[model samples]
Target: MSFLVMDDGEYSFIWETLCDLQLIFHPKYSREGKIDHKELLGLNIKKVSVMLDRNLLSSLLKLTRDGYLKDEQEMRIIALLMTWMIMNNYPASAGLALKEYATKINDLIEPKRELREFNNIFDYYPSMMWLRLAEGAIDSIPVCPLPTEPFITEIKYNEDDDHLLMHIAEMLHVVYLCRRRELSPVEKMLDFLIWNYKYLLICESTLVYTAMLFTSQSGIKAPKNSGSNDIGKILVGCRNQAWDLNYLSNWSSFHYYEKTMDEIFMFATNDILLKRIFINTYTSGGVGALIEAVFSKSDSQKIFEVVNFNQRNRIKPDFGADPKIYLHQLIEQEKHRVMETISDRGNFNYH
Candidate 1:
């Protein structure tokens, strides 16, 4: 089936419709934002089409119509917009527009995939894309041998190549939260601490032990049948070597970590599936709450002490000396002291 190029009017209508729908469904504007639907419908589209990316959009649509791209690829391209909506915390009102847009777009190429399948693709595509990209990153590392002269020349001369590389890096950054979500609760908390507190010399066993102690004191039931020793051993085996702090200290970094955490907390609290998992797993208000509860100021101080003490008195792991035991003892002593204080308060009479 031949598909004609979308006219300027058509392009403007699509662009304006998307923009209005996005505003209508955006978190800050959803309640108060209003659009004159009839007025918008009656407006001249040609005037507004001048600023839109007409060539790029038309090329993409043309590619789909001409069967240069597979059905799934076309769906994924459409789903990228929905993925953007999800990532930006857009409200559900915008999803209806997105789904309808997807349907209409698919119809242009004689839809082979069902609407339900489209919905499913949209729902999980971000996570799947993240997983695939992560795997690709891992596999593609230790960059294959290339014709170095041409590679250097291409990088030096091609502006488009720079743009492509920057785009890939941005994709990796955007999907980071999805990668973190794949981790277990303890691992997630550990990752959070390591990321936010780079000064802390964290190890897997220390984190696992801390989590266990935190769970014990917080009265939160730990995951059934998952022992600290086993988890710690598994994690420690996979741990990377310590970072070169000197280099990291010199580099300027963005404050995106907190924003990422906020997004995770929002998703955990708002999304039904994520909410269920968050509730069942952490039994806390949200990601930040869980991290704060698990790694309190006192806990942080104690961890530093234990870690530093262990570092000073380094013992080979093969020798039956486990630093986690020291951490466990410290937490138990603190718990005992707290209980004694509670008992003392209980016996005191109030005026």
Candidate 2:
């Protein structure tokens, strides 16, 4: 059997460039935007084809002649033409155009309503982490060449937190293009953590808190006089047990669970510190400790061993009430936990 391999980078470059060019020529080519079909038809196909592959150029010409180019279709063809120009060594103009597009994207960013409305440390901190990572990623995009001297000595957060979300979404839209053509196991794990920040930080924290709440409410006390290692095991056991219940199952969709399990297996196989971090987040130190450990560059050696246990034999809590009712109670307890922590701290705010 014969098989054909395709270059993802080249394919992405062609398609993205085509779309960019289309938008540049016909600003109204996007959906809900107006377009002049006759204007596109006037383009010199032969001259433009000099810079593009015959197949791509022919498709554009055919679409234009047939008046089938509308909405996103028109935008894509323009980007293709523009991409051909850039690949053919028109970097100067192409670079400028890209900058303009970046500016337009930046303009669309607004402060996220959730961020503004958050009244406690848990939501605020995790949301800030997401905003920071996203902004850092977007700023790292090589749309323009770097200067010899540092352009800015210190990083500053954008006033519009929503822009960070928008910019990150745009990058995710072309993640195949942004990612390295080849990735090692460590790199793959890093990408997974970065891309799925919400799952790792927010959702995982909620799961841990919920599990702890459920365990306490079920009268399942932590092992008395046990060491941190034992505490970690108990927490892990609680989490596994909670997941088996129908109520907590909603906290993680099948897709999320499968991907998380895959990563967990990978971590265990490679003896990655992430496994330690995952288990440590549920300890007495809580998610805040995990964040501190990460940011402070604390050694993972301090983390205790998290023993694996059979999920089948884990604690099965009987709430003696509707699963939905218990689920709501757990959620409210989790929220109260956050509020209590914030109340104890007093006057905490995002910097």
Candidate 3:
């Protein structure tokens, strides 16, 4: 049996579909769009650190300092810290540099332990009820015989890549929700967040600790024109960091750092898919409500079954005969479905 390599156009279509869904859901975001001010800022890195067990921070930092991370691993962990710093009072430049260093050190040495596999999702689990609900969503999607092409084929998707796979499934669900035309804006966001709550919380916690170290080493200041009077300086700094998408370095290592930072910041700030929900929650209700929602649980027996079936049966298919044609067809189907979703409303008013 032969395989078909996915082309640029295929990848572009998948990416664009994701982007279009995001914009359709969240129309207020732009590369230069402003973040609204909020009284309750993000988690306090230092305060959270002092309150938590010291061993947790020491163990992780030790592993990082020992150079145990893999490609994109450090970025994922450091992004949390960068967001923490931005939420606190860390200077945007300083946060950027810390993120860079975190990404650079993994190349220097091997680890005594394979830390990636050892990281437990349960350790970061939210409230018991919340866990059940998220697990339920996980169980809801129909598990097909693993298809070839477009999705994972020969290569087995593992825990590290589960987020990616789960996200694809989640996107399909979002499409399903849209087609039904029954979900409200906030409810849709809640569903998505709850389904991926573990990863989101881990990112948030990891970021808080990461930022704490940076703040301790090099104190951060607010950007110019961003003041107490401005009412949105912290958020503005985050937006500014997201906007500065260009690289400052010519070397490969540093360039990788810059590129990763740009991607993470852009996702954190402008990609309204998740961030907007978070921001809206924080601004209106407060962090406590946000935490509750992130950790809240509901029944998952149905979703769990769907997830279980897919995990066992789905087969990745080869679009080898006509990869581009298959992708175009996929795009058209989604377009038609989206139109059906908005038919009663008459039109999609995208700004």
Candidate 4:
């Protein structure tokens, strides 16, 4: 077979053009009245298709104003959306939430849902890798224009994400439409930012840490070990990169946090405890006391992971508890855990 390659710049333009075209012909998501097909049908349909994208764009803009985390249920959805939006430089992707940018604001929104049990959330949304925001991902915002491509990237109208995106977008629209008159841009944006939920840095850590807190002593890849180190690196790297100018600038509705890195350490330590407990319990205990033991050992990570991520093994789609949850939870949990631990060490001045 012959190999043909499309250049990055060329493919990007082509992809953008395709999406633009889809806005007209397919009209994937036209706003309330930007386009009346009846008006266009009387004339040439193809020629007037250019206006289709504008309507879709308007609709998305309006949707972003809505409250993502209305409650616990909405919090789960909001977390997933944050993960998806931030996984890529979604802010730059017209009419969509800037994942990394929104993440910072989401991060700032305290009392947020703890992702410690993200593994459990994974049961519903499989790719926990994208949701667990690393300190680096948030810190890296100043250096926007992500150096790497998105981890879980997808176009708006692709086969797998088409329905999901549309549904969520519509739901958000309904939310915004309700408060349209009362709230202005600044108010809506702030509301979206402070959408309060718990933040779980522990249970979200990787597998190596899964072995950390459970044992009396640390091990090969303990929170302070080799594997956890890599996890920390990725978390911080991703968070930092998210804020980098290479991705979105300060004005991109995505925050470029140049200040403190405090959360890094906090998230790391907690993630380690959570991962260890969840993996131990999610494996054999299969929703039993062992799960509580893991939680007991974890303190709050277990509960955070379960309630926020797993929804307490309530994830639908029947993926069943197995090695993936073990690995994914451990890996992601390890990610934040490592960063937090290393960050804590970095702040160590007394030693």
TM-score of 4: 0.17
Report how far residue 331 has shifted in candidate 3, in Å.
0.9
Ordered list by TM-score, greatest first: 3, 2, 1, 4
Stretches > 4 Å off in candidate 3: 1-176, 183-298, 344-351
In candidate 3, what are the lDDT values of residues 20-56, reduced to their tens digit? Answer: 3332111122221232113112322222110111122
How does candidate 3 fare on TM-score? 0.24
lDDT of 2 at 48: 22
Runs in model 2 with CA error above 4 Å?
A: 1-304, 307-313, 316-321, 342-351
Off by over 4 Å in 1: 1-9, 16-67, 72-192, 199-351
- Expressed as tens digits, the lDDT of each residue in 1-351 for candidate 1 is 112233455435434543443322111112112323344334333111111111223323433334233444333333333333343333222212222233335332222222222233334333334222222321111211212121111111211122222222222221231233355544444443443233223333223323543344443222222222232221222111011111111110111242333221111011122222223233323333433555667654554555466567654332126444443443344334323433444542211
Tell me which of candidates 3 and 4 scores higher on lDDT.
Answer: 3
Which regions of candidate 4 deviate over 4 angstroms?
A: 1-197, 200-220, 224-279, 291-351
Q: Residue 261: error of model 2 in Å?
A: 18
